[model samples]
Target: MEMSNMPLGGHWVLVIIMIILATWVIYRYLAPQNAKEWRNAGLIQGFIIALYAEMYGFPLTIYLLTGFFGLEIPWLHMRGHLWSTLLGLGDVGAMIEMIIGLGLVILGLLLLARGWSQVYKAQKENRLVTDGLYTYVRHPQYTGIFLILFGQLVHWPTILTLLLFPVIVVAYIYLARQEESAMRKAFGQKYVEYMKRTRMFFPEIKNWKLLFKKG
Candidate 1:
């Protein structure tokens, strides 16, 4: 297909449907019942909204930087699917990106489900959760978000969304630190012990590996 002949509007429609599905999933299944501090909720909500807007709505970043993309790419056109443009691939190549993107989507949902289950169970009983995915990462839900964004980056990679990637990482780091302080205060020595045993984002493979070592 000729560069100018490719249809892009359909891609936007797909993005819109995906965003709605994401919002519904979070609100219906993952939203916390315990009263979340307004500030923390607000920050998280803002991040989600920003991500959805660019992912589905106007796509400002893609539109604004059309020239650079157009000039740099020879066979591709800005009027094509945004994913293809950002990933620097053709239609067939974008099929691969879509497959990868879908895998990330499933991974994100699974992580979110696991994290939410742990958090909810703990919150209901008024206790700390340090098991399952929590045993693997202190903030699996945040990790889930990061993975979802990573997938979207692979899927779309618009300038605005791409720029927001590092911002999301830094924001999550700060939020995680603040959350840890609160968790530590709530759980005290137990949390301290858990912290000693667990690495925040990366796993402590040496210690984990020892569990499987033969005597």
Candidate 2:
């Protein structure tokens, strides 16, 4: 996977545009309520900037690692996909990255779409969203976003983004708490009952049979 002499790939404009478009989509079709919730979007955009900037504009992590650690880590390798080069899997690494990234991304977007759709319908009818994807997890939208951020890290693990990942997780966790507090006020005992039954972020594996039976 050593391609020290190779020129950098993954153009900056395309990556920037992709991030902008992603931000737009997140705001439009899959937005969370309140200004506090919007902070997640801002953090996500920061991650994207750090991610693609290194991904295309510069190999900051690679350079830093090679400079500080004095390890000859195949500079300019794998088009700034450090994870691939570091693993020494070469093409296999690239394929694994693509597969994992794509899988998580598709799953994330699907969850976001379905979760939001359910929420919208519930809101229209003046009911709390307790069915569909919400039956398994209280915050499928946040979970979707979490998956997307992790997926990007898997695709290309830059230093900045790796650091930003946990921050993003904590931000989402806080946001989820805030969201749940609001939901509790709106729905009262019903939401409390739902909370007692369902977990946030992760579904209960113990309820697999019941989940299979869900509509």
Model 2, CA-based lDDT: 0.77
- Enumerate residue pairs that collide in model 1: none
Q: Candidate 2 residues 1-215, lDDT tens each?
A: 45545666457796778778777868865665778767778788888888777777777887888899775666554544666767777767777887898788777777777777888888799888788888888888888888887888888788888998999899888878987898889889989999999999888787534433425
lDDT score at residue 35, model 2, on the 0-100 scale: 83
TM-score of each: 0.71, 0.85
The 10-residue segment of model 1 with minimum total lDDT is 71-80
lDDT of each: 0.64, 0.77
Off by over 4 Å in 1: 1-6, 10-17, 28-62, 72-89, 204-215
- Give the C-alpha lDDT of model 1: 0.64
Please provide, for model 1 over 77-196, each residue's C-alpha lDDT reduced to its tens digit, 9 standing for 90 to 100. 333346664567766776788789768867776677767777888889988888777676787787776777788777656665566677767866886898899888888899989988
